[model samples]
Target: MGLEEEIQELEDEIADTPYNKSTEAHIGRLKSKLAEKKEKLEQQQSGSGGGGGYGVEKHGDATVALVGFPSVGKSTLLNALTNAESETGSYEFTTLDVYPGMLKHKGANIQILDVPGLIEGAAGGRGGGKEVLSVVRTADLIVFMVSVFEIDQYDRLREELYKNKIRLDTEPPRVNIRKKAKDGLTVNSSVDLDLDEETVKSVLREHGYVNADVTIGEQVDLDRLIDGVMDNREYVPSIVAVNKADLIEPDYLPTVESELEERDIDPEEAIFISAEEEKGLDGLTERIWDELGLIRIYMDKPGRGVDYEEPLILREGDTVDDACRKLGGSFDERFRFARVTGPSAKHDEQQVGRDHELADEDVLRIVARK
Candidate 1:
């Protein structure tokens, strides 16, 4: 039988089987097997030269992939946010290539990519989905665009990305494994876990772990455990942007908000905008800035005042060392100490070393060795 057929059979069995303590291990094995088959199939397709993958060169401070179903205002949103003139229409699949656009906000150049709208079976290489998803995997953040009236498309779009091995808005499972020549499998967990040791062993064995040491730091479900075992998944942060807000009346706002609530998305958290009319776009840009976690650091160059006009941009949690690296050349290697006067510093002009963490709008002066 073909690998796809085998995958289908496994999926059918897993779905048809009843779940309980008695069958938990059995289900785990089935899931592990299913994941392996899917991986193999994907590898096979890639080796056969499936379709063309969009050549998306990451630009600016960070790259954001705008994704959703066709004709869901993704192109419109891209045009509204950046200078890219993505062809927009009232029909599906208007964007056949990955359109690149730059969104400059708060002294940072953020690249926004308008990818082709995803379909139901896109993850399975349908309609050249593997190529599109490949580009998305390279992005730092995902901007999910959906029509205000078709908020349900959010779930479908997310599912397609999930099936393509993209884990949105979630961190990777903290499951560490060490392979051993012998002595059988050993499982250790720091916290109480739902899946017992035997079930964990069963899943690991299915993934070809004959003798290994497994350490799990958190209580993980079956899917997470499988994710931990596999290394092909991409974990990305995503935000929902409901487009076509201008078309909806104020009275109908509550209805749309309720639909967002049904999808477990906080209505207040989701950005409602009219990409066509360019309404609520400021809020959307703010969301992108916040999500990207980009921070601005004003450099205090010698004989030069703080360059606040053209401040250096970095990600959150960046340290003095990272700032120096961004500065490039001799700044990192010849740096002796840095003085910071901002939110990250304890006091104004506090002298710090390379390990000092920087905050947004921090005035930084680096003193290097002569």
Candidate 2:
């Protein structure tokens, strides 16, 4: 049978099969088969070379994508956060195209993208889903904007992203698989594994692994094992913003926050704001900056004072050599050493080498060869 037919058959088999401790292995194998078919189908469909999706080149220090159901004020948020003129409306799907904006915060430039609103079946290519969902996979951060009244829609948006293999606020399963020529399946786990060896072997076999070495770093159940074996996934960090807070009463805002907390939303991730009213924007900006983990490097010239107005923006853990490369010249080849005067240095004007790791607000002066 074809991939679709095979997928449907496997789905039907999995649905009809009894789900229990005894039938777990059978169900797992069937699910693995289904996942493989679905992946293959997606590849085949996307491999057609037809390009009609919204493609935004990543710019600035980092790129953050605004994702939510329609009429969640993503356009308004983009305008408030950046200099982009994203059209806003009271209707759904107002953002027909990807709108790019730049948010300048703490001497760092952050690119904010207002994408088409997502709906149910988005990952399945519904309601311009393929184009919209494709942009989020490349985001450094996903701002899940939902209306204060429709706070529950955040779960639905997250679920759709999950179905598309975009894992938000989650880490990849700690399982590794190494294929071999003839060595039979050997499963080893550093921690207690709940999935039986036979089940693991069956799932691997369904994924076309007849012989392999499986290593599990942590305790994982059958679903985790399958996820590891499937292996085509993206782990992204996401934050949920409750927009249009001005529409709600002040006293009722606490109740809304309480409901969000009960749903296990992190206080840092879940914030109340009204983009139109420009309320709580500073907190939102700070939260985005912190979540992105950016570091600023101050550059100084010889006999000139440091320009703290626009510092060199770099990702956390970036080194001096990386900062030099950002200058867009042959400075990397002409590099000798640098003077450091920040938390990373011993004292004022300490001479450091090229490999010195830089810290935030560190003043640097690169000395080139004569």
Candidate 3:
């Protein structure tokens, strides 16, 4: 049985154990520790190397994963982004094994994994499902793939996550646009035209929000109007690639563009691409890296007579205070200040307190009097 199952079994046995007043208090503490350990085990099992074969491979420093449904250009995109020489085919299940590739971006090496395809009933071992599902559960971020041709694809993806009880905290992808006039504007990729109250009302009518006074600067109650239209999943900050854009006619592009705008989806966030043809792949790669929000920092060795490198190596979080706390009470008590260099530091001097947030590519020199 898995560690999780074993933990659950132990919990059941412990609950049934005869407990006096004194033993009851100790039982609670033991249960809490058991719960914490179980959570950590689950986290490890989800990632490759933690327990499953889905551990994050270290490239230079950064880690990334390419995730999506089968035949959604996931492997193709991975090959393009990393040049990993992974086998790519048109057929389903071409990539049975997970493939790891190194992608260099912004002077940082990012390890990208092309995970196996997922289908319906995956969580329950349908089509060798549990394997791929477990692999994805470990990913820091998922590159959710969808074809532009599939109507209501976004909604379907959400339903699948719901079925598995996988809660995703994705921030809604949106763009801020300032309107010159109070009247609503019809947003297009190339041109922005005035969409008066009448046009807004008409669009609302089509969505069944009839007789609704749709006006600019007025709060449009999203729930009262449309059901299951807006994606409630916390936006994972993604760049939308409208794949197979070339398949549709030129004239239809405007209509698709307008529809996306009506939904408040940013046109800039949407990239027109043909993954098969490698068209617009460069732009897509740039967008993905930008949205990932990663920074790489290099550490330098401290000079002799005042060596602090040993204790600083234990630091994990991107902050001076975090580094101090990791050194235990000795460093914390003797902690005078921290001399931070690189991006986050304001000056080339010792920083005052612990609240200073460290940035990527920062070289820090912590100060403590003996």
Candidate 4:
């Protein structure tokens, strides 16, 4: 049988199997096979040009994908938030191509993409599934734009993204697998794992690792372990922007917010806005800024203090070496240290090295080899 047929058979087996201690190992092995088959199918699709992936070059300090179903005011939101000329209409799939826009906020240029609308079966390569989601995988954040009346679409959208290997609002699993030349597969866990050792070994064996060492540092389920084994998954941060809020009644806002809340979605982070009326856009921009978690590091000169204008934009938790590399060419390799001031520095101008982590609003002065 073909890879697709094998994948379907494995999926059917996994669905038919009852979940308990007895069948857990069998189910895990089936899932591993299923994942491998799907990966092979993806490879075939790529080779045959069946999945013509989107090719929008990443720009600005960060990229945010405006994703939703058709006629959800994504184009309008794109135009309202940035200087993009994406066509807007009151019909489905108005934005056919990925339109790029630059939103300048808090001294940072954030690139927002308005891609073609998604639909049901998008995860199965329908409605430009691979193309649209490929762009999403490249995004630093995904702003799910849903209409006020179609609030339930959030769940469907998330489901499709999840199926596409885009783990929204989730961190990477803290599981590690090491292959050894000898000894059977040994499983070690720092925390309580939902899957037993037999199940883990079965999954590992299905993935072509007959002998290996597995370390589970976090409380993980079977699916999480499989995700750790498969290295192609992308974890992205996400937020929601309920568009066309002006059409809804003022009293109805609470119901919408409550719906998102009941689903464990943070209502406080969800922005209610009308793209046509250009309402609540500042709040949306602020939310995007905070979600990106960016930091600014000002460059300091000896005896001249910090150059507050044109600060180096860096992500949170970036080190001094990262900052040096951003400056380009041999800076990181230069034989010298740096002087730091601000929250990260103990004193006014403390001497630091490449490994020093930088904080927001910090001032850095590098003294390279003479």
Identify the leading candidate in terms of TM-score. 1
User: Any runs in candidate 3 off by more than 4 Å, and if so which?
Assistant: 1-62, 170-239, 246-249, 258-264, 298-317, 321-337, 350-355, 360-363, 366-370
Which pairs of residues have clashing backbones in candidate 1? none
Residues 195-297, candidate 4: write the lDDT tens digits. 8888999989999997799998998788889998886789999999999999988899889888888778787878889999999999999889889988889
lDDT of 3 by residue, 1-370 (tens): 8776777776886677676554443444344444444545645645643334444344444445565566777678778778586777777778876777777666656667787656655543445455655555555455555566652455555455533434455432232233343443432222231323333333333333433232233222222111122222222333456676668888787777766575455666677787778888788767656656554444443564333232233213456676666546777777777776766777765465777777655666667787
TM-score of each: 0.97, 0.91, 0.54, 0.94
Query: For model 2, how does the per-residue alpha-carbon lDDT over 1-370 read when each residue is reduced to its tens digit?
Result: 7888998898899889988778988888888888888898888777774646676888999989899888889999999989999999998888887899999999989999897757745766655677777888889999988888877887788888887888888789988999889978999988876777788889999999988999989877766778888887878898888899899887887778777887788655687889999998998898899899898888997678898999999878888889999976878888999999998899999999878888888999999875
Clashes of each: 0, 0, 11, 0
Higher-ranked by TM-score: 2 or 3 = 2
How many angstroms is residue 300 displaced in model 4 relative to the true structure, after the best TM-score fit?
Answer: 2.4
- Order the candidates by lDDT, highest first — what do you get? 1, 4, 2, 3
Winner by TM-score between candidate 3 and candidate 1: 1
The alpha-carbon deviation from the true structure for residue 330 of candidate 3, after best TM-score superposition, in angstroms, is 13
| lDDT per model vs. reference | 0.91, 0.85, 0.55, 0.87
Q: Against the hidden true structure, what lDDT does model 2 obtain? A: 0.85
TM-score of 4: 0.94
